[model samples]
Target: MSAEGEQYGSSEEEDMYSDDGQEMEEDEQGEAPAAQAQPVLGPKEWVGLASMPAATQQALLNALGKLRGRNVNEMTVIFIGKQGVGKSSTVNTLLNERVAPSSPFQPENVRPLLAGRMAAGFTLNVLDTPGLLEGDSVSARGLMALRAALNGRKVDAFVFTDRLDTWRVDNADRAIFTALAENFGAELWERTILGFSHAQTTPTDGKPYEQFVAARVEQYRAAVRSTLGMKNLALPYVLIENGSRCKTNGDGEKVVNDKPWVTDMVSTMVDVASVGEGYEYDHSKAGKKLDPNNKHKIWILPLFLIQVFVLRPLLIGQIKRDVKKAESKAKGKK
Candidate 1:
């Protein structure tokens, strides 16, 4: 087996490569033009707004109001990350409604879900996607599913969710950054907001909470930079605690590290959208498909030519010379 096979497996049905070939072919050929922006028929009312603390509600309204000032009446945000990383819970917390089914023990299905909410003549659409990783590799099936869900819709920003309690970032974490850049485009990163969920955890390293948060943010920023080769990538981050046990401030707003995380998260989303235009899905921007089996096969022709033209001729001449020497020696002896 080749080195890639040993590392990722040779099976055609391997999780990383499964269903990716077709998706990549479609991408390479350029899928249909960006779908027309269809209205989210009969969006649900923002009932959760009334339940939020008055201060948080006003803060959210004020942040979204800035988007209105920019004439962006409708905003769409997508959530993506590894499985069971509180993606759905974050969505629920942000919208203040249980629109996406979430569970700690069981991972959601591979299907993507879109939930739209309307408030004060503004529309907010959130797309919750399946986990992007399967085992140690990026799951092509999950990417394919997310692409289908998007269907060329314009996205204002992306919320990349992960657990803050996890101390280490591994190759799998970096692979996600590469996969996203390859499948969707490097431009997506510019509009992405790093959402560190489970933000209410105590630092086991005995570091100050702010210091620990800063270190964690830098770790992920470095990963994104190294993986995507974007050394200057500026990633805006939001600390999130999706648990019901999260502490509340005097105004009844959920607080993480004494800050109203929900308000800050929403404000950051608005900031991301205001900085750039909405990202419309374009398959043409996708990177060329990588064939794992044929990745390093370019050396095959050169090696083959050496074996047949150079090595074969040398071997044949050597054999004839040896045979003639043997015959001459036998005749002399006779």
Candidate 2:
């Protein structure tokens, strides 16, 4: 038996590379490549997934249901920032539930949850990570966890939650951004959306979103554009207030009760998820027909795995390590 066959058994190995010959033929003939086959969600796979708690499974299923027909297999969003930036609250708002614990003085609260979803099909799983602060020591375990969680996962988008009310460009933010670029590649900024949460705290008298962007065009727009090298790096920021949604007037006016910022944030997420080409499914047939471009099929499977297995765990580990380190330092001081 071949070396791979010895590891996975001959049958499994055969199944894994079953399409190798066909792929080679298409490549040699200069024919358009066939759509990659979907990973069979078999009994073993389901059982492995079922190891997660029932609640997690249900949450994942709910998220999946919301994404059905979008041709998305999985999506993961991680919230990173210093404590008190409302990362937990932002996650709760996104999931429409208080799944993540939040507190005022508690700089670090809960370990990352598989916040939104945990299953097969299309789902958005969120990770609420510990705050990365300037001059703070980050644990290797935390870094490992983050790396593992992100491995093989297709990040639809990332939200960098910063408190603009106390906006100071900090080393922690820079460090985290640098680490993300190193691990995930520089293109991550293109897939990232900066969420300046606690925007309601910003005095309404200062300036509107567009005006603010215009005023600090260099700091806000140009800096990010030049650093990320993406012309469209000007991300939208939202003002979020607990217990109330911002509303807007119909005539393109900001209503007193309008949460246009919140709406914009949500809309941006939808837009990101909607990007990349989509496949047309022909329901008339016994099985759905995949796109000839094979883009969707090729990307979705690995994306799903990364979100479920890698990103969530890594974020959680990072949070836990940070929390423990904070506790240790506190004890030492006492």
Candidate 3:
């Protein structure tokens, strides 16, 4: 079977797949589930679809077809990470076009941008967001921009990007993960695809490539689990190399760790979408407790009532009693 003709499931990810977002059922006699009904998706002219490698285009089609079979007609994936981590590059690479602006010297603006494409009645919307971190902290402006950009759209999945070549996961990593969970809710992890960009780098420590990748993945997994307090969190990850010099297989598709990352990414996305849940962003719900204008406002009236109606009367009575006692003491002295 050809690369796309065969099922595109990654052998390395088979174990992770069963644990990550897939839901299954068993009959009374424990018979295998029947095949899903593959609904027809009307073909639309996606601008970059035809330009991608034949294998990549076929893999994408298969993934989208799986979604259509499960009655999902649209998929919205948002890419988010710190500055210069290749979020925009991943977006461009996945869509097979430069739909997003990615420049090493030029930083993305605080505002996020959403780009959409259509093929075979399946709509794919990708939101490329600004860097969520500013120096060591989460950027408030970026969070506000992301919330506004989403504009209450239902996000089917999130691709959280980071550098696979980074040597360590520090407090900054934990802070970003916590900030996302706080602003977007812990449910975001349920549909998250951890995209470790710059996957084509060699380890400086002289370790084997696969071993280095595993260690890096574990570092992120530990950080997310520790910071979010979700010990059982199963974070599915995909390695991505978006550079022009990335190595390609015989099919002219980008390969990392001997697997075509584009196909793996799309297949993983389809799995997450099949989990039957999408994150609904509510502008009113996010950052309310942290917003100074709204935080503690409800307690303002109650605090004022306690000060005036409760404390003032007691204070006045105590003063009057002190005055009478002073007068009585004066009389006794006389």
Q: Which number leads on lDDT?
A: 1
List the lowest-lDDT window of 10 residues for candidate 1.
1-10
- Scored by lDDT, model 1 comes in at 0.75
Model 2: weakest 10-residue lDDT segment is: 1-10
Q: Kindly list the per-residue Cα lDDT of model 2 for residues 1-334, writing each as its tens digit.
A: 0111001111311121111111011123222123333222221122223443344445445545545656566665667656677877777655455455665654453223334333464445566655554345333223333332343345666677766555455445455554444444565566666676555444455777656533432354454554456667646545555435444355332222254443456556655656653222222221211111232577898998999899989999999999999999999999
The clash count of every prediction, one per candidate, is 0, 13, 0
Q: Candidate 3, overall lDDT? A: 0.72
Q: Rank the candidates by lDDT, best first.
A: 1, 3, 2
Clashing pairs in 1: none
lDDT per residue for candidate 1 within 87-124, as digits (tens), equals: 97887788777666676665475556666778888888
For candidate 3, write residues 100-120 as lDDT tens digits.
567777646445555566887
> Whole-model Cα lDDT per candidate?
0.75, 0.48, 0.72
Q: Is candidate 1 or 2 superior in TM-score?
A: 1
Q: How does each model score on TM-score? A: 0.77, 0.51, 0.73
- For model 1, state the Cα shift of residue 215 in Å: 0.3
